[model samples]
Target: MSPHPALSEEERARIDYLVPMDHPFDFRPAPEVPRYPETVRRNALSNHPLLRREAARHHQLPPDLVARLAADDDLGVRGLLAQNHPDTPAPHLLRSFLEYTGPERSHLTSRPNFPTEGAGRLRRPRGP
Candidate 1:
């Protein structure tokens, strides 16, 4: 059986509302930087491991939830944590990315938000 149960359409849609389809990185515009569905905010179970893992991608997921997700075993979620964790939330996991030897490490290097010290290339020029 799949370790993470398949998400239903509605569930996927809810996830999308926070992390848009093409934008992909749990992104926000930096000042308002992260936001999520009201249900996610209000639901007590929002901190459940799966929710924590999914919400970690949003620039806006609360620090507490990010902590919970980091504590989970899902490497993909940690990859999201590496790319997303704006406001400098998870320092250790960010360091761990360099130690990880998987494709997910790309999250740290490729995302525009990665710290300049860790990023390989200069800021990308605008493209059309």
Candidate 2:
């Protein structure tokens, strides 16, 4: 037998507040104070997905950090980079478009660098 069979409503609400599935994008303005390069780099490498997502949302991230977040395994991190970061590479945007099925996925297709051409090559032929 388990000690706790299910989460209480309050616990569920708290979890949802911490990580809302419907609203994946964090639009709150980042701090105006300049962050040190090392701090930015550390955030990029943090094990916590929320921290990585924040790093991806920063407007002035170096190209290397943008690339690092674009390649992060977490879908939220990569999606945020593709949606918010101006310097995000086109390949990363394409990968995010293919992988992320969130509500904002349609918005990704409208990004300036998202690859609209060559998608036909990704389709597999039906087996006879």
Candidate 3:
């Protein structure tokens, strides 16, 4: 979240109507959200979760941006990298990020990824 007013109240309100999807679930009439200023729209477009997710999928996303997205508050955004993004975070970093999630979110990290033997590790609590 911006500590400064990067978004006006009207622009901020528009963001509430926009939904970032991992995949489309249902179709609906696009809501009539207010338009944002060009600067706001450009900034929003660059950081849009869909864009971020796709960027995170690439091994070439700039390291700084990858690092920034690693700390993104949105779990899905975080998962986009944490779950084997080629330059996927190390096991320790994955633990640090995914630990915030419950079992339901584990599938994202539970792929044949991580430094573990199988996806089974994610479905069960880590052993001591």
The best candidate in terms of TM-score = 2
Model 1: pairs clashing at backbone N, Cα or C within 3 Å:
26-57, 34-60
TM-score of candidate 1 against the unseen true structure: 0.44
lDDT of 2 by residue, 41-76 (tens): 766876556667767877778888887888787788
lDDT of 3 by residue, 1-128 (tens): 32124655555545644445444211122226633344333432354554444444443445666667677655555665555344545663455344545333544444334556554555657699
Q: Is candidate 1 or candidate 2 better by lDDT?
A: 2
User: Which RMSD values do the candidates have, in order?
Assistant: 9.7, 9.0, 9.6
Model 2 has an lDDT value of 0.70
List the candidates' TM-scores in order.
Answer: 0.44, 0.65, 0.44
Best-to-worst lDDT order: 2, 1, 3
Task: Give me the runs in candidate 3 sitting further than 4 Å from their true place.
Answer: 1-13, 18-47, 91-93, 96-113, 116-128
Residues 71-113, candidate 1, lDDT per residue (tens digit)? Answer: 6565545555666666434354555455455544555554544
Q: Pairs clashing in candidate 2?
A: none
Candidate ranking (TM-score, best to worst): 2, 3, 1
Which is the better candidate, 2 or 3, if ranked by TM-score?
Answer: 2
